[model samples]
Target: MVFAMLSHAAIAQDQTVIEIQSPVLVIDQDRLFAETRLGSRAQADFEAHAQALAAENQRIEAELIAREQELTELRPNTAPEEFRAMADEFDARVERIRSEQDEKARLLNRSREEARQNFFGEVAEIISEIVRDKGAVVVIDRRDVFLSADRIDITEEAIALVNEKLE
Candidate 1:
């Protein structure tokens, strides 16, 4: 009888009380948005580069159009052999420009990938530091956690730590 009572008491003590709030994850969402917006220096650079590339492409297209018009106007007056040579030259130039544009696009993609890796590395480092400081065994997304007390909400603290590092 004593063993049965002791086992019952132990089981009761091990039970957890759960209280869930629908808006609990909102706190973490705000912190994440604020931190991401503040820390996205690479993102700004990427945008600027993208704009420049687009402008250059537009300019190249305009130039090609003008060149094609000039070639067409010159065609009716030229000897057949000379016209063929000029057309060949124009084709070669267009091909070269296409190749160069492909290379430029590849370079841009590589640079963006490198910037992404660097940004994520910094974020992970800041999060690890916050985890250590907060004595949290593991951190999960707020949406995944079923319930926890207000004391367990460390999202703002982690965001602050990330912002400090970003600055």
Candidate 2:
């Protein structure tokens, strides 16, 4: 009778262990961001803004070059003091333009970061929903796992959920 009881207890313990294992789902967050509609739109907007900034920088640089060329042409004919004043003014303008451009670049970076944070916030909620629906006890980023079966990956499902929620 003791032997049978011990065997029954061991079987129950094994069953509990099996139940505790649950399921682990992996998500490729990079893939999620790259494939999602919202992410793609954000990327496109950022690229467009960056291109506009680059064009404006080019225009300002061209103007600076023109001013420098004009200064070079006037240098020999102009009085020393007058030439010095023009050079000083040109240097100051260049500095001001550079400062403004730096500030604009910093603002763009901050905006991009904020957008990313918002995207991740939405994704986190979607992931939680998916975990509950799929009976998964743990969800890990695919990048963190060195070896995982493709069957355990829920990236596509997660992306679908994200798209549905975001849209």
Candidate 3:
């Protein structure tokens, strides 16, 4: 039970003017990636991976619980010094496991972010093409814009094109 003691623990807004000199398009970039085939597939893949990680954590927790029980059982018969060393080694092992698991979680989050960014990059060219076709100079995230007129937004159009063009 002593080994269990050691291992533990653990938005913004704004809006801007609509009509500028140059044509501006707004994209719900989140929606765009979330809707496309590539984005959808990436998301599903990452989610599955995340679930696997969760299962792994649960498994580790169970194993640790069992280890703690075993250690507790041995504590009474063992010599004080020997038990202390055993506890210390057990603590060290737990620390390493924690560090490794934490790193894995970080890597998972980083990979998810990187996948999102890469999806955005892949869609960027599609966005550019739409921009050129519409004679727009700049595109803004839909969430950022304070106000905007209808028909100017090319998010839906971009999504359509992205799904159509990319796998």
List runs of model 3 lying over 4 Å from the truth: 1-22
State residue 130's C-alpha deviation in candidate 1, in Å: 3.9
Q: How many residue pairs clash in each candidate?
A: 0, 0, 1
Greater TM-score among 1 and 3 belongs to 3
Error of 3 at 167 (Å): 3.2
lDDT of 3 by residue, 1-167 (tens): 55454333100111223332337888888889889899999999999999999999999999988998999999999999999998998899899999999999999999999999999988888889888877789999989999977557777888899999996
Clash pairs, model 3 backbone: 16-146
lDDT of 1 at 31: 48
Worst 10 residues of 1 by lDDT: 17-26
- Higher TM-score: candidate 1 or 2? 2
Model 2 misplaced stretches (Cα beyond 4 Å): 1-24, 145-147
Best by lDDT: 2
All-Cα superposition RMSD per candidate: 7.8, 6.5, 18.1
Model 1 per-residue lDDT tens digits across residues 1-167:
99999999876564422112222222363345445745456667877998899899999999999999999999999998999999999999999999998899899989987876666576776666665655544656677667766655767776776677677
Candidates in descending TM-score order: 3, 2, 1
Judge candidate 3 at residue 17 and give its lDDT. 33
